[model samples]
Target chain A: MKIALAQISPILQDVRKNINRHLKLAEKAKKERADLIVFPELSLTGYTLQDLVPEAAINPNKDDSFDAFRLISKEISIVLGFVEEKGKGSFYNSAAFISGGEVLHIHRKVFLPTYGMFDEAKFFSQGKDISAFQTPFGKTGLLICYDFLNYGANYVLFSQGADIIIALSAAPGRGINENDAFASSHMWELMGETVSRFSTAFVIYCNRVGFEDGKSFAGGSFIYSPEGTAICRASYIDEDFLIEELDLSLLRKARQKLMYKRDNKPEVILKNLYRAVFKNED
Target chain B: MKINTVFVERILTKFIKDELGKFHFKKAVLGLSGGLDSSVTAFLCAKAIGAENVLAIIMPYGESIKKDISDAKKVVKQLGINSKTIHINPMVDAYYSKYPIQNRVIKGNKMARERMSILYDFSSREKAMVIGTSNKTELLLGYGTIHGDMASGINPIGDLYKTQVRQLGKHLGIPEEILKKSPSAGFWPGQTDEKEIGIDYENIDNILYQIVDLRKQKKEVAAMGFSQKTIDRLVEMIKNSEFKRKLPLIPKISERTVGHDFLLPYDWGK
Candidate 1:
């Protein structure tokens, strides 16, 4: 199956522009005969809304904001990030898995990072369960940023038979370096390592590029094979599309060669890792 | 100004070992670029948790130049921290070979990202938290890379402005060469940050303080006699790059979360 990673630059707080950009990228992905196109986290309304999040929230079922994407997804699976109204007063930062002109499933972000400049907890609600969507391609798992750092629940999606993992993120700030220049791609490397080591499936990461909120995102969108080798990578600091063919057989072969499994966790060893690292508390 | 090394060291020690020490992190890893940012960051980490507790990785690619390595070594010698130099030239060169790049701007960015890849590997292997080196000026201007140089376990100098960083550097008793050298991202040998950005640090430091953190409007800035173009650019940077100041927002579905619902600190348990 061919998957397209959309590394797009979205205009903050401008839903129409963001939706338009998604539509264009989705079309571009379709033109390339991609079976699936993944986008960055909250690409519809840039990541730094804070109190403005309420104004930016849209209901996928009723908002009509996703109609274009839904129509475009008829050609291929589209996983684009947006805000979804949950209850009467609450909302979720979500990614809609649209296939065949329908909103197939929605995966709300599980981890809401609040440290440093991140104020997501002030605006968003967390998701409880791991979600996998059924596409014409395969059972695909959807996760937003922050959760990318936590693979425990993500592993659950794989155990449930997800053959592909797509992560959408708008990770800001730099890493250990001076400027926010190198952190996003490095984090992608870490993500690739983790996903390959655990699930042994096709892992696709789509990150936002350009400066949004005083933080510049490096695109570096890519596809990692089950063997942990990079299949295709997008450019940095510019909007680009990376379309690549993924072999399902490779995943099966890699999994068979794997020694450890998440399901077969040794209680003592698990306890020791957490206890030694986390120490006291519990 | 009489630099009070003892006084500053006392505060930093308390923050690094005693206060942040509450986490009982196994180790702290810093990217020693041999530049001002990394040098200052390494010194702060060494002081915060002792030399033995801090791990410094000198990541250099082909474009990193020889001066960078020597400067990194000088900082290591001065601080007496645990250090290792790893050349990423082969890995990055191979990466670019696969995805050939033409533009210098794009290549520079790739270099930064490649260097970060090495830093993270060392970070995980050593079981250390990555410390950030971005100052307030760079953070305000969206001058950094997301997840590359920006993704840190914790940032100690994030709140300090450029001038304040220099002040703190002097107070921390960092080496003269490190404190005196012209600031550069070290992406290309001749490419300095000021040249790329088209503004010097001194002017940017003063203007950013008056505007961003201070919340002064354009008129107020103009009244300060700064050019309209500079003020306009600064404000545009601050306003347009606002997304740089957040976590990748999650659509809230749960009752509690860090960015959406709970809004608590990472060390809230403490």
Candidate 2:
């Protein structure tokens, strides 16, 4: 399966322009015979929306703002991010998997980071669901930026038999590391490798590029094979479109060799979690 | 705290290009003070948008050192960027002459503001944005004049420390004399930043890195061998000048006050 990573710089708060950008990129990806194209978190409205979040959000089920994406999905599967307005005042940082002109699955970001340099909790509500959905490639799961950092988020998806984990991020480029990589990008790469290796699933990370209020998004998008090896990666601090072929057979080979999934013990983890949560009762 | 100069260069150049691009600006203007900070900024700006697109305005007061002026000229020549030397002495001296302020701080502030006004004038004249040169050490220590040398459309090097700026200067091949020169605001004939701050940049930057970036407590910072008195003094400076770093305080009168509830990112709607 060929996956396209669109490391694009979305115009801030301009959903119309971003929609057009998505269509153009999706067309290019389709021309290259890609099975799926993935975009970064908040790819539709750009990161750092702040006060503009409510204005840029759209009800994907009812609004016509997503029509362009739906029409484009008829040619190629697309996984793009946006602000999803579920009701009147509730908004979520969300990603939608659209294929065959239908919204297949929508994942609201589970982690709304509110700490230093992040203010997502102020404008967005946390998503409560974590599940894998069927796709043409295989069982697929979605994780937004901060969600990827949570081990439980990835574990749940993998435990539900997800073969591919598509992680979208608009992470800011921060701290120059000893290896000449953004410290944040290095952390993401480490996490991607760890998750891919343990879960034995393909980890496709798509991070955005460009600046918003002097905060530059690190754009080191990559695909980690089930063996914890990075097969393909986009450039750092710049917009790039990466197209790479994923040998689905590797997933089987990795799982067969590792047998982590076969010998998994989620029940043990669940018991520990229950014990930790209800220690007083115990 | 060693920085990857190559990576730093790449990101800073991209920052200048992208930040200016957002405002539909292809050109940049900055006051060239012949210091490490301004020289490095000029180099990065020239590399971002072609050298021809960057303009270095050297605004020298009467008390400004001649060697500093020569070093500023050297940078312009080396980078092959546009240059304009505007003497701020007349305007600043004229203002002080009318009021007759004997304090050097007040006089120095006027010169800084005068240079700022001139940079803005050239900004409009060249249809360029005024790029800032204040480094992280100065900004964090609040060692700069508010709304004077600190004002700009965008700051590419504000996050980099003074020591890191020197490291970047070395990478950019800045003139040895300028790079090795004592840090100064050029407010007076023999004034130096170290003399005014009572701490060398090496010590200041290290202390700041521990306290600010690493979030080390005063006791912890003292454990790292920084004097408690120095740490306390730096902390006091940071606290006192906190107002300079922020937009003017607006009391919350309305439900959605400007700086309180109605928070917006700087690049909103752009």
Candidate 3:
């Protein structure tokens, strides 16, 4: 399956303009025969929406604002990010998978970073669920930016027999690493490698570019094979569209070689977690 | 503390271009003081939009160093940007003549504010945004006059320290004289930043990196071999100037006060 990573710079607080940009990129991805196109976190509403969250948010279930995306999803699948208004004054940083002219799955970001330059927790409510959903190619798990940092989120998805993990981010470019790469980008690559290798799943990481109030988003989007090697990647600090084909046979080969999923002990781990949570004695 | 100068140059230039584009501005105006910070800012602005789009205003007082003026002129010539020299001596002298103030600090502040006023006037005249040149070292230690040299429509190098600014200047291929010169505020004939601040930029930047960037405590910083006295002084300066870094405080009377609770990003609705 060919997946297109749309590393776009969303216009802040301008949902209509961002939707138009998304439509244009999706059309280009369709022409290249891509089965699915993935956009970065908050690709529809832009990151750094502090008090403007309510104005930019849309109720994905009933909002007409998503009509354009739903229409385009008939030809190809799309995974885009936006602010989801669930109830009165309750908003979530959400990603929705739209395919066959219907919303397939919605994953709200669980970890909302509140320290340093981030203020997501101030404007967004916490997400409560973590699960892998069915896609045409395989079982796929979706994670927003900070959710990927928590190993438990990826573990839950892999335990559910996910074959692909898609991590979306609007990660800011910060701190120059020794190798001249953004320190945040290097850390993301490391997570992608480790997650894909142990889970024997294809990891597709898509990040945005451009600046919002002087915060520059790092845009080194990439795809790691189940063998834990980057197959394709995009450039940093610039908007780019990357398309790469994923061979399903490699997932099988990787799983057979590593036997991580076959020898997995989720039940045993759960018992330990339950005891630890309740402070129960052995 | 070392930065990748090449990457810093690329990102800063993009920042200048995009920030200007947000407000539909294609031009920028900045006071070129012939120092490393402003020269680096001018270079970034020139590369971001174009040399023709940047305007460098050289405003000097009667006591301003001649070599600094020549260095500013050289930079303008090298970059091929438009420049206009305005002497603030008359305006500053007129104020002092009426008020009869003998304090150099007050007089120096007047000069800085006079230059700022001209830059804003030219900002409207040339239809350009006023770019700021204050580096992180000065801003953290409150070494600049509030609303004088500390005002701008946008600041690209505000987060970069003085040493990092020099590193960036070298990568931008700035003239050797500007890069090698001792940094000065041009407040007096021989006023240098270190002489007034009582600490060199390298040491200041390192201590700031520990306290501000790394969140090290004062005791922790002292343990790292930085002088406790200097650390105490720097910490006190930062504490005393906290108001300068933020908007004016508002008493919380209403349900949603402007500065207290009605928080919004600066680029909102754009």
Candidate 4:
């Protein structure tokens, strides 16, 4: 499978302009023969929308703005993020998987970051589920930014027979160490490598680049092989489109070698979850 | 943490442009102090908003350093940004002449406030915001005069430390003389920041990196080879100056207290 990571800058609070840019980029990716093209979190509207989120959000079932994406997905799958307006006063940071002119899945971002520079909880409702679904490319899992910080999102999807993990992130590049490199990017790389190595599934990270409300989103989007190797990556703070061919055969070999997920311990995990969140009940 | 000058330059420049654009601002106004912090800020504003849109005002008291004025002029000339020389001697001296203040601290505060007023005056005339030049060290140490140098519509260099300011200065190709000179507010004759603060910027930055940035305890900071006295003083300085870094305190007596329980940030639209 050939996957293209479209790391582009979105115009803040301008959904129409952003969707136009996405259409142009997706067309370019389709011309390159990419099976699936992915975009960063909130690709249809820049991050830090604040009160403008409702104006920029789209209702997937009713909004006509997504028509172009659905039409193009007949030839190529597109995984992209947008502010989902389920109804008035209800908004979610969401990502959708589209293929064969139909919407396959919509993953609302479960981890609504409320600390530091994030204020998602003030404007967005949190997602409650983490599951793998059938995709044109086989079982795949989708997650919005901040969901990759913990173990549950990838682990649950991998346990459900996921072959690919797609994440959309709009994280800002921060904390330049002695090397003048972003520590946040380093953390993302560690997350991608660890998740791919453990779950034995292809990990795709698509992060946005450019400034929004004085914040600069670092666009170091990349793909990690099932063996935990970085196949290709984009530069930080620059818009880029990266396409790389993936070998499904490697996933089988990776799973066989690691067998981390095959050692299924669902009951053990449930017990731990209960112990962590339901201590008073116990 | 260190950063590449070019990379940071691009990001900061873009940030300024985007932020200013969001506020419908087309110009930036900042006081040119001829010091490292101000020079870096002026350079960024010129680069971000354009030299044409940046207005650098040189506010000098009667006793202000001649080299400082020369350095400030040199920066404006090099960047080719619009500039004005505002002699604040009359305004500051008028108040002091009546008050008959003898203390250097009082005089310094007056000078800082005088310069800040001049910057705001030009900001009003030019339709630009008063961009601040205080770096992280000065802010953390409370070395800056409250409501004086700390006032700004937007500050690009507030997060940068004195050491980082020099690093960025060197990166922006700032003149060596300006970059290496001992930092001084030029409020009084023969005044230097280190001499007044009783600590050099390097040690202050290191201790701050540990205690504030690294979130280390006082014990951990002392273990990192900082003297307990220095650590205690620095920590106290940071703690005391916390008010300068945030909005004024609004004691919560009612059901909803502004700037606290009922807080709605600037982006929390109506």
lDDT by residue for model 3 (A1-282), tens: 999999988988899998998999899999999999999999998998888999999998788988889999999899999999997779999999999899999999999999989989999999999889999989999999999989999999999999999998999988863345688889999999999999999999999999998899999999999989999889899889998999989998998899999999999999998988898654
Best candidate (score: DockQ): 2
When 1 and 3 are scored with DockQ, the better candidate is 3
Ranking by lDDT: 2, 3, 4, 1
Question: What does the lDDT read for residue B52 in candidate 3?
Answer: 99
| Model 4 stretches astray by more than 4 angstroms | A51-56, A253-258, A261-282, B24-26, B49-53, B97-100, B127-129, B249-270
lDDT score for candidate 3 against the true structure: 0.91
True interface contacts reproduced by each model, as a fraction? Answer: 0.00, 0.84, 0.60, 0.26
Candidate 2 lDDT over A126-223, as tens digits, reads 99998899999999999999999999999999899999999999999887755577988989999999999999999999999888888889899999
User: lDDT of model 3 at residue A9?
Assistant: 89
Q: Write the per-residue lDDT of candidate 4 for residues B171-197, one digit (tens) a residue.
A: 898899999988876667688888876
lDDT string, candidate 1, B162-254, tens digits = 766787788777778878777776667887767866778888877887775557887898898888898788778877767877887888887
Ranking 1 against 4 by DockQ, winner: 4
Off by over 4 Å in 2: A280-282
Flag clash pairs in model 4: none
